[model samples]
Target: MVDGKGKKMSKSAGNVMAPKKIIDQQGAEILRLWVASENYREDIRVSNEILKRLTESYRKIRNTFRYLLGNLNDFDPVKPIGYR
Candidate 1:
């Protein structure tokens, strides 16, 4: 979690982020983004509010990819398009 004040996230600082809560609320990608976006030198704060928002977006994306892959598995590209 970030104080949004340039402080570092650490257990000693009482700003440690929870993984289960983050995944449960933010899905995963957003949490991933937060990890990628933030500098390791500084601490990040991850409140439930942010987690919930990002999770919904992540869920939509996850479902879309699943649907596409599942549907594409039944395709038959070998049938000559013009002949069949």
Candidate 2:
């Protein structure tokens, strides 16, 4: 594990990040998403910068879903709408 500054996370170094802390602050879903999104083929870096970017991406995804749902609210299921 690596800290936000790219330093190796270690108990001796007092830089280890507690899982509970991350889950508490960002939720379990965000933590899971971060792990799943990574390649995991090599050393993984966990930093505030990475988390910030991931949070921003998650927000964008939520906004996109909201926009799509809002636009579809006016559509009628009984009548198929023609797409351009």
Best model number under lDDT: 2
Return the lDDT, model 2, position 22: 80
User: TM-score for all predictions?
Assistant: 0.51, 0.79
The worst-scoring run of ten residues by lDDT in candidate 2 lies at: 42-51
Screening candidate 1 with a backbone cut-off below 3 angstroms (N, C-alpha, C), the clashing residue pairs are: 1-44, 1-45, 1-46, 2-44, 2-45, 7-43, 8-43, 9-43, 26-55
Top model by TM-score, which number?
2
lDDT of 1 by residue, 6-61 (tens): 46677887776678766775556787966665567745556656556556766798
Candidate 1 structure lDDT: 0.68
* Local distance difference test values of all predictions, in order: 0.68, 0.81
Instruction: Give the Cα RMSD of candidate 1.
Output: 4.5
Q: Model 1 Cα displacement at 47 (Å)? A: 2.0
Question: What's each prediction's clash count?
Answer: 9, 0
